[model samples]
Target: MSYTLGVDIGTFETKGVLVDASGAIIAQATRSHKMLVPQPGWAEHCAETDWWGDFVYVTKALLCDSQVNSEEIAAVACSAIGPCMLPVNAAGKPLMNGVLYGVDTRAAAQITELTERIGADLIMARCGNALTSQSVGPKILWLKQQRPEIYALTAKVLSATPYLTWKLTGDYVIDHYTAANFSPLYDVNKLAWTDDLAADILPLDRLPRLAWSTEIAGHVTAQAAQETGLAVGTPVTVGTIDAAAEAVSVGVKDPGEMMMMYGSTIFMIQLTALPVRDARMWYAPWLYPGQHASMAGLATSGTLTHWFRDQFARELGEGAFGVLAREAADSPKGAKGLLCLPYFSGERTPIHDPQAVGAFFGLNLTHSRGDLFRAVLEGIASGTAHVMEVCRALGTEPVRVLAVGGGTKNAVWMQATSDIGAVPQIVAENTIGASYGDAFLAAVAVGRVLPDEISVWNPVARVVQPVAEAVYARQYPLWKRLYSQSRDVAHELGGGA
Candidate 1:
């Protein structure tokens, strides 16, 4: 039987998945990789040293664990966070470290310049996206202006997915989804790089050709095969950003379905028959193509939980999130009138303020650390509600919400998210997320399943419905306005702290 492999290079880890022709994942592996913080706001990954290198490590490890021969693999696909600025030389090597996504906001000057050049309303109206920490356009301009020396040698600027695609196939090409993130550079309406903008925006003269995420980007080369332990000449599908791939893995293709990922950040993706554009949210092409994805992402969700556990929960010892969650689960709804904004390191969507910091409002002496901890979970759950309500307001019907990510492991947190969203949350059988979705996409590309038959491989683990309606209805509106009142103070405290 033939198998397919999908690899994902995420912010802090690289993951790989192996799926047989029938669409079931046979094996999965992951490798932790460090994110380089060169400056306070700068985040980078070494393409060869960490990104592509760990991808190869996980790929081989997955195949080996699955007991699958290299020759039996039919196709491969990869996913990575992007709309990044990775300038590679003629030989396809990164000129320097690969700057990460919106999490890195070192390009403030570039963003300011681009914002002035193209009026905010014009950019928002034309591109269907605004320049936030998310867009790659400003980052490219930043490099050209700040590091002219490296920019001069750049043969091509590639997003993370193409960087690995080039590593696998010896060709440089960007997928449509990845290209869309290059706002101000790409024209969404025309589905091509904009001549009007590209005329002045750095040299797109050497930009890579664009393709659909499922297309066969190129064949695996001997060098890639040796490094990843896959067979030479293995066909690899042009992959997409991690969020899209994960949505596909969770069977979020049908128009009304929503895929909620509870990983380092909480991201929601709902498939749509037509474009659903809102400056507050995101819009992208789906992994299967031909349809748009309405996306909502919270800048800090699980990340805040991690920070809390590391700093304060250590006194409680290991598995702090688990123990703290159990205690918080018993706390009264609304955490006994306590609320958290959860913008520890800025925020995205609904309120797109980067300077916004997290805070606990309505806190009283009666509140314990456990009550505060549970309040953080509730804060994140309310954050999901913020995104979900936006999708509803934007005209996308999010019928069945599926939860996939590290956040699902906490039963209390999952239930809390479902409660706030007012939608039942189902967990996927294998929640390794985007990498698994990439594998499933590869399996389909290789004839493992008919395009429509992809759902057979994905099954629900459990469906958690929203709790008592009265509780959610009362708390929901109050949760929304806390951000409005606290955001300014959040900014003030954030600057000083």
Candidate 2:
């Protein structure tokens, strides 16, 4: 039987999975990696040491465990986080560690510069996006100003997913789903890179070849085959960002569907008839050709919990999240009048400010660890609620929200999200996040399964409905007010990024 391989490069880990043509997972492996924070705002990754290192280790682990011959692997696909900018030498060698996505905001000054020079409205009109930590254009400008020598010898710029694809096939290609986010470098109306507009920003020809997310970029080479333990000549499909791929893994096939990814950050992707161009929300091409996906995200979700556990409950160990979640779930709906602003990494969607700081409001001496913990959970749910409201304001409410990612393992968080969103969240049976979807893309490429067959492998694990409307109605307004009030203080404290 033919097989497909999906590799997902994430902030905290690299995951690889092997699945049969019918979408049954045969083997799965994970290799944890480190997120480098040389400075508070500068998050980076060693493309060679960590990424390639973890990749080399995990590929063999998965294939060996699956007992599947390398030649049986019909196709390969990769998905990773992005809008990330990485400079590579002319020989396709990395010049520096891979700069991260929104989490790393070292280029905040560059963002301000670009917004002033090009004008936000003009940029929004041309690129369908506003200046934020997530866009690549400003990051590239930062490289030019900060590391001119590296920028001079740069052969191409790449995002996280394309970097992996290039390593596999020796072909530098990026999908439109990713290229569209390159901002001023991409002409929204024309749907192609514009040499005239970005002549001063990026090299026109050095940019990776663009394709739809399903298009096969090239075949795996003997070099990649040796490292990955995969057959040479296996077709490699161009993959999109982790958020987009997760949407595909959970069966976001039609319009009016939303995918909620719960990981290092919280993100929402809703399929829309036309691209939504709000400065608060983002518009990206979906996995299919000519389709658009609307995106919304918060800077902190799971990370806040991780921080709480690491910084506060170090003694609790393995059961920290579960223990805290249980305490929070038992607490009152409002967590006894405490609210958390989940701007720990600054905010993403709806408020693209890196200067925002996370806070706890209405805290009193009477508050216990349970109340604080629950409020933190509720706070992230509230942030997601804001995204749902934005989607509604943009003229689409998802009929059903499909939940995927690490946070899905926590039922309390899932319920909290559904309660705040006021929508039913259907948890997927297989929630391996983007990697699973990447494999599905490979399955499509190899003709092992039709694009429509995704639903067969993706079935719901459970469903949850909103809890209380009155509580959410009051909380949302307060959440909105917090942004304006917190921004000034956040800037003063230099808390963003």
Candidate 3:
């Protein structure tokens, strides 16, 4: 039977899947990795190790575990966290550690500089995005200004997915979904790179050729085959950013359908018939040609819960999260007056404040750990609600929200998010996430399946409905006020640091 192989490089892990032509997953594998935080507001990943190494390991493991013949795999596709910035030399070797996505705020100065120089109105008009940490253009300028020596030797700037595709196919190409993150460099109207804007960031020649997500980039080279366990000449599609693939995994195809990814950070993508331009949110060309997407993301979500587990609940061991979830479930809604601002890594979307700080207001000595944990979940949910509010205000509200990612397993968090956002979330049957979506995209690339077949591949498993909660409604305003009232203090503390 014919099969397709897919792999995705994520912030904290890499996963792969082997799926038959009928959309049944034959086998799956995952490898964990650390996200390197060199300094406050700076995030990096070793491209050679965290990206390529994990891809090779996961691919080999999936092939072995599934006992699938290398030749039987019809095509290969991959997705990864982006839009990351990884400058490479002539031979495609990484010049330094790869800079991560919106989570990394080291380029804030460059973002401001670019916004002032090019004007925010013009950027929004041309790129359909403002100068935020999510944009790769500022990061490119940061590299050129901060590390000129590396910039001088840079041959190409690649994101996570493009880099993986290049290593396998020996072609430098990027998909339109990820290319849109190169704001000020990508022209949304023309659907191509803008030489004038790109000139301000980096040499135009250093950019990779752009393609739609489902198009075939090239075939796996013999060298790549030797490194990976796949056969030579296997076709590799030009994959996209992880969120887009995850959205596909859950059948977020029709316009107004949205995918809420509960990963390291909370990422939201809503399919649109045409681009929606708003500085508060981001707009990009969707995976399929002629489609568009409106996206929003929180800088921190599950990341905050992870920190709590590691720091406060280490005694719980492997069952820490489960135990914590139970405790949070028992805690009263709104965490009994405790409100948290989930800006642990600063705020993205709506606020776009890198200096924003996380805090637990109304915390009292009487509060238990359960209350604190529940507060954390509510904090993230409130942040997500804020994003949805902005989307609705801008006339791009999602008609349906499909929930996907590891965080979906946490009942308390899922419920809290739905309740706070006042939107029901549909969980797909196979939320194995972007890797599974990558496999499906590979099938589309080779004409094994049509784009509309995703619902058949992964149907809605269940739905999380919002329970009317007056506490959350009352606390949300306070949550918003907390940040505004404390912004000066947060900035002062940040400046001191």
Best by lDDT: 3
lDDT by residue (tens digit), candidate 3, 1-497: 39999999999999999999889999999999999998999988999999999999999998899888898999999999999999999999999999999999999999999988888899999999998999999999999999999999999999999999999999999999899999889998898889665475887789999999999999999999999989999999999999999999999989999999999999999998878888888899999889999999999888899999999899999999999999999999999899999999999998999999999999788899999999999999999999989988878788999999999999989999999989999999999999999999999999999999999999889999999899988999999999999999999999999
Q: What is the lDDT of residue 219 in candidate 1?
A: 98
Q: What is the lDDT of residue 484 in candidate 1?
A: 80
- TM-score-best of 1 and 3: 3
lDDT value, candidate 2, whole model: 0.84
C-alpha lDDT values of all predictions: 0.81, 0.84, 0.93
User: For model 1, how does the per-residue alpha-carbon lDDT over 19-46 read when each residue is reduced to its tens digit?
Assistant: 7777766888888887787866677888
Ranking of models by lDDT: 3, 2, 1
* Regions of model 2 farther than 4 Å from truth: 495-497
lDDT of 3 at 414: 94
- Candidate 2 on 367-445: residue-level lDDT in tens? 9888898888889998898888887886787887899999888777777788887888888889888889989998888
Q: Following a full C-alpha superposition, what root-mean-square deviation does model 1 have from the true structure?
A: 2.1
The better candidate by TM-score, 2 or 3, is 3
